[model samples]
Target: MKITPELVEHVALLSRLELTEEQKAQFSRELSKIFEYVEQLGEVDVSGVEPTAHPLPQKNKFRPDEVVPGLANETALANAPETEDVYFKVPQVL
Candidate 1:
């Protein structure tokens, strides 16, 4: 598609941008080049290529879950500066 001054002005209005005449012209040229390159890319053949999320092989690197003994509540509460019943107490936050 051809990039025109009208298209640039429309885009500027949509994007809430206030481009000068020079800026509009510069952006029009740059955007036209980008669109041309994308159009060229669309002409390439890739019928046999497989679509992939990553270039390299990827696998979930999760560790195995195992049941383990946990610290007793009394032992955990022993080091606390403040405690209310079996739980630690802290200053109230707004």
Candidate 2:
């Protein structure tokens, strides 16, 4: 299908684009060519093709989950510039 100047104007309005007359003409030609290509694709017949999620098959590789002791509070808090009793302290924000 051919894209008319009116259609280009509408598209420009929808996209909030400020197109010069030259740009509008250029876009109209490009959009028409794209529409023609799509029209050609519409003529292809693919009746029973199965929809695929991915072109290539893949398997998830994961490590086994295990409970382990983490760093103690003293070690974890060693890098903090400020800490209260057992927790890091930060300036109060309102």
lDDT by residue (tens digit), candidate 1, 1-94? 6788789999999999999999999989999988887898688898998888898998889887987889899999999999999999999967
Instruction: Tell me the lDDT of candidate 2.
Output: 0.91
lDDT tens readout by residue for model 2, 19-86: 99999899999999999888986777879988789998889989879888999999999999999988
Q: Candidate 1 overall Cα lDDT vs. reference?
A: 0.90
**lDDT accuracy of residue 35 in candidate 1:** 84
Stretches of model 1 off by over 4 angstroms after superposition:
44-94
Candidate with top lDDT is 2
Candidate 2 Cα misplacement greater than 4 A, ranges: 45-94
Candidate 2's TM-score: 0.45
